[model samples]
Every structure is written in C-alpha cells, then in structure tokens.
Target chain A: MVIKRKVAVVGAGMTLFRRRMLETGKELCFEAASMALESAGISMRDVDAVVLGSAPDAFDGVHMKGEYLLDGAGGVGKPYTRVFVGGGTGVFAPIAGWWHVASGLFDTCLVVCEEKMSSLHPHPQYAFWGIFDHTLERPLGVNLLWIFALEMRRYMHVYGISEEEIAHVAVKNKRNALDHPCAQLAAKITVEDVMRSEPIVWPIKRLDSSPPSDGAAAVVLASEDTARRICKEPVWIDGVGWSIDSAYWTDRELAYPAYLAEAARMAYRMAGIEEPRREIDVAEVYDPFSYKELHHLEGLGLADKGKAAEMTVAGVTARDGDMPVNPSGGLLGVGNPIAAAGMMKVCEVFWQLSGNAGKRQVKKDVRTGLAQAWGDLMQFSSVIIMRS
Target chain B: MKEGVVKKGQDIGVGRGIEPNPVGSKYAGIEVKESDLRDGRYMSIRYSAMFRYRWDTGIAVGRFLEGLRDGRIVGSRCNVCKRILVPPRVFCELDFAQIDDWVYVYDTGRVNTYSISYIDKQARRMSSPVIVAVVELDGASQGMGIMHLLGEVRPEDVYVGMRVKAVWRSREERKGAITDIVYFKPL
Candidate 1:
C-alpha cells in the first residue's frame, strides 16, 4: 500500500435537478455550497481551497465558466482550480479536492459542480455537437444520440441483448427515483412503457434517457485530522481513480468501455477490493442512458460482462438487493446536468456510507460504496470509493 | 468589504460570532417552467459565442482533403503498427511514431454500426430521418471507421456489416471537404 494520508467527505449537498432553473449558475453554486458547509457545521473561513467542475463553457454560453463560477464556489480568494472531464467532472472535482487534502497541502477543500444547460439556445443537446470531431464526424451533421445509439446497437449485437432487457433499467431506475426528492423524472413506468416511448434514435427511447437539467451538487472534503475534529461520522474516500481514452471514438470498440474498466481497476487496486461484487455494498454507476448503467456496472467490475442486465432483471441491483446500485435514482431518473450528475453520485455515496440516505437508502447495512461516472464521448471514467 | 458594512473584527460579538438563524426549509434552487421563459416572466439574456476562426487542417488532414477532392479516400499507414488510420493522422497514437506512408483506401466499406436519426445536431426534428453509420472503409485497418451519412436505404433495411459505397458529387461540384462525398449508399 502507498500509506497515503487519509481524506474524507465531511459534508455533501445538492440543488434540485430540473429542466430549467430560475437561479443563475452562480446562485446555484452558492446554494449548494452553503448547504454543504452547513451540513458540515463549517463556514467559508474553514475552507482552504476550492475546486469547481462544470461541463462545456458553451452550455452556459460563458467563455470562462470556471472563473465565472468562482465567487459562488467559495473560491473568490482561496487557492482554486477548475476541473472538467465532461460529465465525469462531478467525481473528478471531488477527486481534485481529495488531492488537496490527501497531498497534505490543505486541511479542508470545497468541491462544487454546477451546470445550467438550459442557457444554451435551441435545446441543451445542441451544445454536444461541438464534442465530435470537426473534420470527419461534425461534417456528417451528427446528433449526440446517434453515437449512443450506435454504441448501444454494437453492445446488443455482441451480447445478443434485446431492447426489452435494456428497457428494464429505465423502468427500475425511474421507480427507484420516486423516493428521491431531487429527482426530475421519477415515475412508475414499465418496460412496455419504455418500449412504447418516442424513439430519439433507434434503440434509444425518450424514456430510456435522462433529461437535460440545470442543477448543482457540492461536497466538502477534509483531512483526516480535520474530519475527526469537525464531523461525528465522515465518509472516507478510500480510493479515487480516473482514466481517459482516445478521442478517436469511431476507431474504438463500442461494445465495451475499456477506459472505464481501466479506471475501475485503478480504484479497486487502491481500495484493496479484489472482488468488487462481494466487497462493494452499494454503487451509483453513471446512467445517462439506461443501457449505460449496465455498461458501467460491467466496466466497474461490479458484475460480469453481459451480466449487469441479468442482475437488474434478477433484482440483485435493486434498492434492497445484494449489491444495490443507483439508490440515488441516478442520472436517468434524477436528471443529468453533465458534471453535476457525476458529483451527485459522489454525494449520494457519501450519504449512503454515512447512513444519511433516507428513503432511497439500501436495505442492508452499507459500509463501503462506490460512485463512478463516464463522460467525454464515452472515453472517460472517474471512480470514488467511500467507506464509513 | 462593501461600503458602510460593519467589519466582522469590529463587531460587538468579538470572539464569539452571532448565531445564524437560517430561514428557508426547502432545498436550494428555484424551478421555472419553459413557459416562463417564453412569457418573459423571468428575465434572460440571449447571447452567442461571437468569435470564430478557421482551423488549420494541418499536414495529414490537408492531404486527406486533397485526396477527397480527387475522388479518393486517403489514409496514413504506420510502419511500426502496420495499421492504416482512416481520416488520416500524422502520428500513430498506439505506436507513438510518425506515419508518412499515405494509402488510398477503397471508397466502399462495411457498416460497423448505424442509427436512424430523427433529430439533427440541434436536437430539432427532421422531416425525414437521416441514416448515419460508422463505415469501416476497405483497405484500412479493420474497425478503423469514419462516421458518415448512410443514404439510398431505408432505416429498417440498414444493418451491421452491410456493404456500402460512397456516393460522390460530380467533379465540378467537388470541394476539398468531407461533404464532397455526399453519403454512402448500399452497393
């Protein structure tokens, strides 16, 4: 083992995820940061550094999104860094905070992620067009869903999976979301409902996808000594890992996410979790699309390849199941605001490990949990393991 | 630091800070319906990114475009990996070596995967669905695909591994761009 300094998430908070929020991006950051500080029983004076995570600057129509969101993130004068890994930024921001504490450079760090996708005109989805390659992919006039659909198709063809099997994820996640106060698309829909929904791209229905939302999530990370002094029970970030693959997404195999697997391996190795399925009590895998939840679970080594869907179908991934996943309703039900969605997973895991997750809490005692997020043209993954 | 505001150090509380009685009980954030924006109830400013510049296509892509203008799909081959990178690159990401050998790939290819896109890049509904496919061009490394539009085929008719050929515009209409090859049609 590396025998590094311990770091823990002392407090966590988030605003409601919605299609459009009246609060400006800065206000949203402030509100979430305030709630997190209050939860930790601390004030701005206690924070030694600040880290902000947000998606594309174009989404907010701002040139410098990090600097623009500085004051609200409690980073006005403190040592600050803005981290972005597309949607993976949520966990990545906290990981940056972990470095601040773990590096013994700061006693306490505040990590905040905010995304106001509604600011972009002609729908927030339009902002993603810039993510594709300008020379080859952009000239084809591509939509984001088209690529996801292509990936989903490849996964299905390889595994002999059916759309019905994937629809079950949407059904389960939406139902689980009903208990979440911050959820935007909570419902009691069935697989048939998902199958009948409007198809944005073939193999991907409207119900199978998360909504474009404007929201923010935050967490306060503290050094072990500071955590012991301030919080009664802190969720320790036992492991943190992130990896990014090639930008030539077309050349890679869409059937599996090799980058996410590499990231998960890195996290598991640090956490000393050789058997993720047995050791991990709960997980919040990214579910931007219904199939992605299964895809990520497989990538995280929480389930066997081509078997995550079976776990969902068999109730092994339910709220009360053996290895509960997405007890926060995930991005599919809760709403995805790019970077904030990943941060929301980190917050959910913190709450889960600390026994703070209320109705959405898993049935069994959860001592260890993981939050993983994928982003940037299906090429990036960030994982954080938390233990109480 | 605001004008006329009392400094915390000069306050009567001194070392003991005043108690904060936070008021609102609800979670943070105020939700607004889309109608509010249309009605102008909540103020908003319409802004667009004003700055724009042309990207230099660079050495590898510059030649690739030249090849397309001449009715050919050019790729660069890495001697170390022996892999022909489509939509050519000056360097091989895997081998970490510069690639100078330019290979002309067959215009025909097989569809690796595809989608019937009912929405455009702006998420706007299109009158007719645009069929998009990742075509792995022949003579290039296996799985070395480039994203392009699929045409002259129905959405239901498209399948993985479907052989297709590029439908290029006439010589006069040719421009040194990806659009010169309009779409790929089933052979």
Candidate 2:
C-alpha cells in the first residue's frame, strides 16, 4: 500500500464561463484564487504551496504561461509548479495539489486552472494546429473538428448509434444548465430540433459542440489535520489517478477511451470502489462534445460499453435521475474554458457531495462522487474520487 | 574528418594569377596582439506557435447570423429533447444527434444573468462600462437565452429575471455580428 497522507478539499470557487471575458488570464486567476481562499474562510497567507494548470499556452497567446500567471495565482516566491496535459490539466491540478499534501510536503495547497480561449485570433480552433506534429501532421492542414468528426463517426459505427441519440446529451445538459448561474449556452430543445440544426462537419452539428470560452476555477486542498482545524465538512480526496496514451492518435481505436478506463481503474482500486455504478452517487464527465459525455461514462465504468447513450436516453443520467451526471450542466451548457472546464466538474462533484448545490441538487442522498477530465488529442485522462 | 590545403600560386592563385605574388603583403615584424574576447557567451533562443482553424456556421447558424443582421432572433427545436435552442444549431447535444426543426423567436426576453465589465482583455479602461447579459426568450425554457449586450440600464439596476427587449442597429449598420444588436433595454 502506498502510505499517502489523507487529503481534503476545503474550498472551491470559479468565475462565470463566457465566450469572451474582459478579465485577462491573470485577473481571472487572481479572482478565482481569492474566492477559493475566502470560501475556505482562510487567507492566501494560509496556502503553503501552489499548483497551476492551464490548457494550451496558445489559447492565451502567451509563452511559459505558468510563470506569467504566477503572480496572479499567488505563487510568486513560493514552492510553485505548473503541470499540463491539455484538457486534463484542470483535474490534474488538484491532483497535483493532493500530492503536495499527501506526500506530507505541504499542509495546504492552492490549485488553480485557467483558460482564455477567446484571445486566439481567427478562432481558437486554429491554436489546435500545434497539437499535431510540426513536421508530419501540420502540413496536412487538419482542423480539430475533422478528428472529432472521425471519432464520432467511428463511435456511431461501432455502437450502431445514431446522431439523434447522441443529441440528447446536448438537450439534457443544456436543460439541466437552466439552474446554473455560470452557464453559457443553456437551452431546451427536442430531437427534431437537433436533427434540423445546421451541420458544421458531417455528423457534428453546431449544437453538438461546446463554445470557445474564457474562465478560471480554483480550489484549496489541505492535509487531514489541517482540514480538520481550518474548515467544516471537508470533502475527502479518496483517490486520484491520471494516465496518458500514445501521441500517435491514429494508431489507436477512436471508438473508446482506453486511457480513461485504465485511469478510472487505478482510481477505483485506490478508493476501494468495486461497483462504480452503485458506489458513486453523482458524476461529472467532460463533455466538450456531447458524445464525449457518453463515451466518458463508459470509460469511467458508470455504464457498460455501448450502453451510456441508452442510459442517457432513459433519463437515468438527469439531475433527478439515478446517476445524475453533469449536475452543473457540464461543459456543454456551462461553457468549456478548457482547463477551467475540468475544474468546474470537480467543483460540481464537491458541491454535490457536500449538499451545497442549491437548485441543481440531485434527488438522492450522496456520499461519494467522481469527476473525470480528458484532453490532448484524446490522449490523456484524469480521475478524482471524492467522499463526504 | 579529412584535412586538405591549397598551395599559393600552385593549386590555387592568391592574386593576379601567375603574375602577382601569392602572398601579397609582408610586415617587417609580426606583433601578436591578443585582447580578452572570452567575456561574451552564446545564448540559445526558443520559439513556440499555435495553429489556426476556420469554422463554418453552416446553413442553420448562417440563417441565425442573417437573423441577427435582420434584427430578429431564431431558435431551432429538437424532436427528442423537445426544447428550443437559440442561435439555432443543426444537431442536439446529448445523443450525437441532429435537428431539422427551426422556429423564429420573439425579440422579447428577460435577463437570465449578467455581468458588468470594467476593462477589456488588455486591461485597458473603457470609455463607458459594458453590461453583458444572457436573455431568456419569453417562450423558451428557464435557461435558454442569447448572450448579448445590455443597454439603457444602469449597472446597479440590472438584475436577474429583469424583463427586457432587443434593440437592433440600423440596416446599414448591421454586420452579422453579435454587436449588430446594439443592446437590450428594460421593457
């Protein structure tokens, strides 16, 4: 057994997700970090270390963004480090913070994730070009949507699923976002509405996508002793796991997230969870694209392979449903700020486990929750399990 | 590595072919002057870049953009979810789905949520404060709304659920952007 110290999340905070934000990346970081500290009823002086996570430096048009954001994140002159694995950076930030406390190196840590995708000119999707190989892949002039469309096509083919079925995830999530204060694109629509919507790429319509957004989220982590002394009802970090797959995306099957499954297995083993569907009360799966939610649900072991879409169609994943996924409306409805979007999922899990979710509360008593974020050309996965 | 040399006036000529001396200038005494040039050091530089992508709004979003230019709001309905989506999209989000039903929405909507921006991305002060808001259409669901600018209301007066109406720019001034609709005013 790895003799890791107990870790708890004592505070959480976030800025509203939007397509464009007047606040620069640093300002957003400072605002969110300050709020997290305040929510814990502690000051920035109480934080012993800092871990910063931001998706692509291209999104902000800044190089070595970690160092540039240091002052705003309150990491200046402290034991600060930056870690990123594309979209997974959000949840990974807190997990990194967990290690700082779990290793008994720091009593408290401030974890922050920020992304300003709106700053990228001619559309932020252009920034994704660098995610490919400079020599071999860049010459192809591939857009990020091409890959997602190809994967979506593969998923539909393997599962015999229709585009209409996957559209329900968008409908449900956007509807659920009705109660979310920070939602960017929340709406109530039907299957016919989705089917009739304009197509961006074949199979991926305008409605199936998450918008380019600007936002930041932050959380405070502490050791068991520090948690007990500083806050009430601390959410325990029972397990944390992350994994990366090969960069050669074409070499792997696009129909499933094998990396996510492995990452979830590692987390489950550490958290002592055998039957995730039964043990976990709520979930926040990354849904940059609507199909990703179902894809991730299967990866997280919450539903069997090729069955997540069916469960979603059956209303089992709604806020009042048995599983209650994306209670914060998820990245689909709530807006995806990349790194910040993943942290939003973590924050939703924290809120649900603590019964702090006001209007969006699920209909069951929750004790355990799971949150996962995926990114990097579909190569990385990060999982975190929390318990009250 | 292989070593090779050229002999003056033999394999290679120094000047004026065979007519001139291979070694042109000669000094009476050779004085070696060495200066301390070791103080400078070489530095390596690094560069990074991001890719760019072009997105097409498709027919539905194209129509929606046209509507914005025409001073109208539009939404599409999903047969499966049975909800209206503003800024009409061609597919649903939940099930990897598609939507074909389109509906024109009324300009009347209520403020769902809003924020007052005091600065731009450059951290530059604005001549006037800008109020950005999400407005839920009258018949739309609770969360359904279009994000746009709010005008004619003081920052202090803007509140959640405040009923408002869209104010469009002149036909000549419209540019098919969100800014085409100057702002929303309290109804």
Best by DockQ: 1
Best-matching candidate per TM-score: 1
lDDT of 2 by residue, B1-187 (tens): 1136655555543322112212432101111111211222212123446457665657777778788788887788888888777756687654447988888888888765555544333323356656665577776544566556678989788766689998888999987766677778999
Question: How good is model 1 by TM-score?
Answer: 0.95
Calculate each model's fnat, 2 decimals.
0.78, 0.00
Q: Over the stretch A1-388, how does candidate 1's per-residue lDDT look in tens digits?
A: 4535899899999998999887789999998999999999999999999999999988887879999999898998899999989889888999999988898899999999999999888898888988887776788888899999999998888787889989888888888899888889999998999999988988888998999999999999999999999999999999888999888888889988989989988888988899998999999999999999989998998888888888888889999899988988999899998889999999999888888888988899999999998888889999999999
| Global local distance difference test of model 1 | 0.89
What DockQ values do the models have? 0.62, 0.01
What ranges in model 2 sit over 4 Å off? B1-187
- Poorest 10 consecutive residues of model 1 chain B by lDDT? B13-22
lDDT by residue (A1-388, candidate 2, tens digit) is 6746899999988887877665678988987898788878899888899999998888777989999899989998789999998989988999999999999999999999998887665478777877864432344334566567656766776787888899999999988898887778888978777788766544677788898888889999999998999888899999888988765465356678989999999999999999999999999999988899999999898999899999999999999999999989999899999999999889888888888887988899999999999988888999999999
User: Which window of ten consecutive residues has the lowest lDDT sum in model 2 chain A?
Assistant: A133-142
Worst lDDT run of 10 residues, candidate 2 chain B, spans B25-34
